[model samples]
Target: MSLALVLDLFGTFFFAVSGSLLAARRQFDIVGSLFLGSVAGLGGGVIRDLVLGQVPSAFDRPVYLIPPLAAALVVFFLLGSVERFRRLLLVFDAGGLALFCITGTVKALEAGMNPAASALLGVTTAVGGGLLRDVVANREPQLFNRRDLYAVPAMLGAGLVTVLWHAGMFGTAAALGVAAVVFGLRVLSLHYGWHIPRAAGTWHGSRRE
Candidate 1:
């Protein structure tokens, strides 16, 4: 497989695992876990492909879903056993975010998108599924929170990928470096509780003022 394909698969697996864990924590049915896992793995890619006017890869590439379904099944069977590894699941999610950011940016560039739009799409690819996952689980989307420092790292990684592409340095090595930067930023933010401050007043307050 090409390096991009490999990164796509890895990101799918990592995101699937994260979603599966959430399903397990929520005491969802096995089918629910699998559904969430599949969505988490494929949703962003579907959006990206659709926006670029391409067929969604998941439709033509059934094999791409195997890892996600398998991951859900594994988590389902070991639901209780895996509960102790919450930290590991968070790390895996970060890996998924990083990988998806890099791959999404690369794919958009390859499709001739400008850098700014490509970077935004990369953030979408990084966080889109998690947004859906949160909504389906009846929680607020994390992206709506000012305290969630997730998308910034994705933008940074995506920007790096776009820069590399322009510099003719885009390849497996540079991609990996960008992914690592995103992952590192995510992990550090999680560890240190880093976030920008929310705006001080509500929208209504400003209008009244």
Candidate 2:
């Protein structure tokens, strides 16, 4: 497999693991965990393909389904051990975000998308599956909330890849390097509680005596 394809597979596996663990934490049954894991693994790629006017890449290959299913099975058996695996979940999720961000930006640029569009597509590809998983599990989507620095890191990663490609560095080495930078940034942000600032506002009410 090519380097890009390998990174995609790794990202898919980690996304699936994150989704499965979320379902297990919610006390969902095995079927639910499998379903969520599959969605979280493939949903973003499906959306990315649709937007790019192509058939979903995951459907074209069996490897796509295998990894998520394997992840679901593993999480299902270890459902009760969730607390012990929290750190692993964070690491995998961060790695997946970085991998998908780079891959998605590369694919978008390959399709002749503009830099801004490519970055947006990359962010969507990094977080779309997790958003869907959260919605399905009846929780607020993490990307939309201000709790974490999730989407910003992906955007930075995508932007970096785009900049590198524009600078004539569109190769496997460049992609991996960009992904590593994104991964490190994301992990550090999580460790240090780094986040984008939000708009400040105050609410006031008047009462009549």
lDDT by residue (tens digit), candidate 1, 62-95: 8788878888988877767868865766787788
State the TM-score for model 1: 0.91
Question: How many residue pairs clash in model 2?
Answer: 0
The window of 10 residues in a row where model 2 has the poorest summed lDDT is: 200-209
lDDT of 2 at 13: 89
Taking the candidates one at a time, how many backbone clashes does each contain? 0, 0
- Model 2 Cα lDDT, one tens digit per residue, 1-209: 88778888888988899888888888898889889888888888888889999889899988888879999988877767665855666676787788888878888998999999998999899988888888998988877666478888898898988898899977888877878888888788778888775645323343321
